[model samples]
Target: MLVDADDCEIVGEANGSAEMERLLIESAPEVVLCDTSPADALRVIEALSGEGAALVLLGEDHSEYQLMADAVLPGWAYLRKEADRIEILGAIRAAGAGLIAVDRSFSLLPGSAFPLADAEILPPDETLTAREREVLQQMTHGLPNKQIAARLNISQHTVKFHVASILAKLGASSRTEAVTSGARRGLVSL
Candidate 1:
């Protein structure tokens, strides 16, 4: 089953660890959002080591997954369930871009800690034009071409033209891939 939220899409859903691993192998999505216990989420993350998929874990507290993220998964995000929608989406976007995006709430947790060295910093490319960057940011919001055009006060043809240029510049074959590349290159923020 597929579920769509914000600018992210869930290509598969699993009820148990075994099923989740199977789905991960089969679908190979760019990012996996898991709302399970820390232990369960750890198992899933370990199982996906070679799959090249990023993770965004949601739980009640930083204690749930902080250590694992710090020690095991460097390019992952652990967000509290009560996190803001923008932060949640940002985490997902960052994970898809192969970056760590831990929520600020975690730092406020009593005795919470993170390994500074675990954070990954991607270098930005300055190839995109100002207009193209605007289009790319709107793409991260999951906007369709028409809506992007209307919001940017441009015609649909212009939006399409920008999208095509973005794809070509990023060497991406699809819109989603282009957005992922943009995020990875620090060119777009969710």
Candidate 2:
């Protein structure tokens, strides 16, 4: 589906690796845009290699995929989900031309070339309830408590409660921080 422009035609779409493999074999578009988690992106990339299609991956975490792309697929582009429309369009076009287009902010290497020694160490497994996880997922869209409550078929008060719990569990002072932390921890996808 076309998101913000009419000039670019969407040849195909897929939700998972198997569907993506089928679409890649059927359509073989010059460029493929996939929005998924890092692990899933790896699976999709592996599933469609040698198909001669450039890949543009949009995800919450880029470092893992960046490393993989550098080692395996030079034509792949990994952009953060929060990337602006211009960046996304540029990445797609560049990838279509068989070139690499990466977000400069994210490094293509693993681990700390520049480590933050004092970074907050979140617990290895901060358990979030199912409802709280759903609320946090909605928060990633920048939705308000009212809209999230309506979408979840819950009361606004309940949404607020879940949000508060999410923030506390994530050690975040605000909704934005909560989403950011959740994404970094692989607890939520963007």
Candidate 3:
């Protein structure tokens, strides 16, 4: 018999995270096999971390959450949905033993969901912090510093600091130019 056959056979199947929750409580199997969107995977792992089972996440190679396996999945195993049978079995066994398992293909970049093997999508400004990226998201919306500050609940001065940093980093002489440049480079939405 396949070592994975027993637990894998009757594991819960849900097309989305909500149904997965109900399935988790009702079936309560030893393992869960799922194909979830990046955000959905985060939610499922958050919900199921302390439940009495291992979760084997199957996701496409480029799924964003595949990059944060450590932080999101404390004790679960995560692997590319395209793994061969042997590798899948190994992850299942490791997860069953209560150890977190990860595919070797993931990277260590914080706040970046891009896979290690792929080229990085550096926001024209390599020096920008993740917080500033949030600011840029608002800037792309044509919000002024005061409005961005109000929406982010940060002080206007802090927003100005980020704007100055963003200007210098992107080599833009003004916020409008920065927004235009950012939109061109896939850094922010127009």
- Work out the TM-score per prediction: 0.52, 0.51, 0.46
Model 3 Cα lDDT, one tens digit per residue, 67-137: 43434333466678777778777777777777766665642223333222223245444757878878988
The residue pairs that clash in candidate 2, if any, are none
Give a tens-digit lDDT track for model 2, residues 87-153.
Answer: 8888888887777766756642333111122244355575687898789989999999999999999
After TM-score superposition, the amount by which residue 28's alpha carbon in candidate 3 deviates from its true location, in angstroms, is 1.1
Provide the global lDDT of candidate 1 against the true structure: 0.74
lDDT of 1 by residue, 83-180 (tens): 66777778888887878776766654433544233233222552788899899999998899999999999999999999998888888898999888
- Candidate 2 worst ten-residue window by lDDT: 108-117
TM-score of 3: 0.46
Q: Give the TM-score of candidate 1.
A: 0.52
What RMSD does each model have against the real structure? 13.0, 13.0, 14.3
* lDDT agreement with native, every candidate: 0.74, 0.73, 0.69
Ranking by TM-score: 1, 2, 3
